[model samples]
Target: MSADVAIIGAGYTGLSTARYLAASGVEPVVIEASRIGWGASGRNGGVVSGKFRIGFAEMARRWDLETARRMHDLGIEAIDHVGETIEELGIKGADYRPTGSLRCAHNQVALDALRAEADWLTGTLGDQAISMLGPEEMKAETGSRDFPGGMLNRHGGVIHPLNYVLGMARALAGQGIRIYCETPVTRLGRTADGIELHTDRGVVRARQVVIATNGYSDLTPATDAVRRRLIPFRSAMIATELLDRPMLEHDRSYTETRRMMRWFRKAGGRLVYGGRGAFGKADSAAAFAALEKAMRRQFPQLAGVAVTHRWSGLVGMTMDSLPHLSRLDDRVTFSLGYNGTGVALASMIGRHAARMVLGQKTDAGLLTSEALRPVPFYEIREPAVRLVAGYYQFLDAIGR
Candidate 1:
């Protein structure tokens, strides 16, 4: 098989790349190991978090203030881009909701920090969409008294993740883009003309290749270096039975400020809660019980609520806690490491990668410009991740 461009992984990023490439009159072949949206793209909490893993102050401390501000603004734009694409394309069955999101603080100290961050975002960054919510306001908005305070971003919201990606896949299929499910690329090598991707069925030769396999990079040998730079972590979620009303007052999605943060939202009359999972395990009965215990602590009213579904997915975590996009060679481009904020950001980055493949300049700014260094002693990343997870839990316990 031969094509102008080839995309591996049919998750949000890969499908988004294919969509834009097709729009540019380039029919790209997309290969997926499983079905479309079978990874984190479909298994996430469905929150369109218009923010990054690192906060604005941390971003400023690491980089400059101006660069930090621009990156934050770019995240907001990425959220808008997703909403625009869904609306413009008339993508149906996505359950797209612009209900916004709330970042809750676990304690008074965290609340004070949240207030300061809100001021910085509104005053310095001129982000009028974000506002601080005190305890009363937060309780009124979220229907939970566990949070001391929170910040609300009017631009952030939620969607049916599986439906969203599947909708994009259907639309791309209508445009004559070849989508081969259950077709995994085992190796990626450079050919004299361009690049060659060897799969179980056959080899696909394309002038340019986009590696969209974010958390599942271990599936492709071409991304070994990239894989070492990313620490794959499992995140698990449980969906409760349909409730009487929305779990949140305004149906707003929410996340706490802890290292092992809890993200939850009301969707389809069910309360969906999720967080980081145990090291080296995808889904387990113990993990689900722990998550349910956390949920009960947060919302005691649902102590006996029935959990209808439990699921888990891998998330690619970068060393610096930021997403990385780069062009490895003239014929190879890739984007990954979303740090759990991939629903919207991945789509935007995928488009940028597509532009890069077409030899067009993209405005990725510091994201693509920053070098992605591999984790130290990455060969033992599994045990290292376990240690890191324990450290985070310890910090959370002491409230440091």
Candidate 2:
């Protein structure tokens, strides 16, 4: 088969790329290794976080003020794009709700930093989408007195992750976009005239290709470039059995501001809480134990709640903590690395990549300004991450 464009991995990034490309009168085909929404896009905390791993102050410090502001706009645009798509496409099963989100500070120092961030957004960037919650308000917002304060973004919400991606696949199909499920692209070859993708079923040739595999980049032999550029870490989550009452006052998404973080929300009348897992383990016994322990530490009242489900997924982390499009070759482009905050970013990055592929104007500040460098100590990243993660956990424990 031959086409103008072929996208790899039918996750949020891939589907978003196809959807936007088709909207522009360009037909694109998507190839997935497994069923649709098989990656992190399908299984996440479901928080619509338009946030970056790097904060506004730090981004400005690293670059310039204008660049930081542009990145800020891009984050907001990402979450907005998701909300608009759900409504515009009329996807009912997505379970989207603009309940807003709270970023809890486990310590007073963290609370102050959160306030400073809010000030920068409002005072510097003129972004008032977020509000600062004091001690009293934090308790009310989080339903826990343990939190000192938080920053609330009404734009951030929750969704049924799997359903969102599936709905997107259906919408793309409605637009004549072909999605080949369980058809893995085994090999990628660069042709003199175009690119060739050797899949399990057949070979496909295209003028250009976008790699949207994200955390699953290493699974495909053709994604060697993407694999080295990303640091894949495991994230585990658990869901409590049906609760007799609501979890929180507002029951929106809640995330703690820390190095080794905990994020959770209420979905399907269950408390879905998640956190970082050891890089060496899978989604079973050992991994879920850490998650349940952390969840219980936060909400010990739920210790008696039965855990109905547990799972793990790889989260691709970038060196810069910014989502980017690296065009190593004109015919090949790679888009990945949301740094674990991709619930809303998946579509946003996809749109940016699609526009760049179309040669249209895109507001990609530092995202495309440079190519991604290889993660340090790539040869032994698992043990390396363990060392770093242990340090971060210590800092977070001491309230640093």
Candidates' C-alpha lDDT: 0.86, 0.85
**Which candidate wins on lDDT?**
1
TM agreement with the true structure for every prediction = 0.97, 0.96
Q: List candidate 2 segments past 4 Å from native.
A: none
Error of 1 at 7 (Å): 0.5
lDDT of 1 by residue, 1-400 (tens): 8999999899999988998898888879999999999988988888987688888877888888988888887888898888887886678988888888888998888889889899988888888998888889988877778888898889878899998988888888887889999988888888789889898899999999998998988876866767888888999999999896545768778889898898899888899999977678456788889999899888888866799999899999999888888887788888998988899998777678888889998877577878777889988889988887889989988887
Tell me which residue pairs clash in candidate 1: none
lDDT of 2 by residue, 1-400 (tens): 9878999999898998888888777879999999998999988878887778888889899889988888888888888888899987777798888888888998989899999889988899888777988889877665678898898878778889999989989987887899999998989998999999998799999988999998899887888888888988899889999987656758689989987888888899999999886576465587688788878878877867899998889888988777778686788887888888888888767778888888777767777885788887789888888898999999998989
RMSD of each: 1.4, 1.4
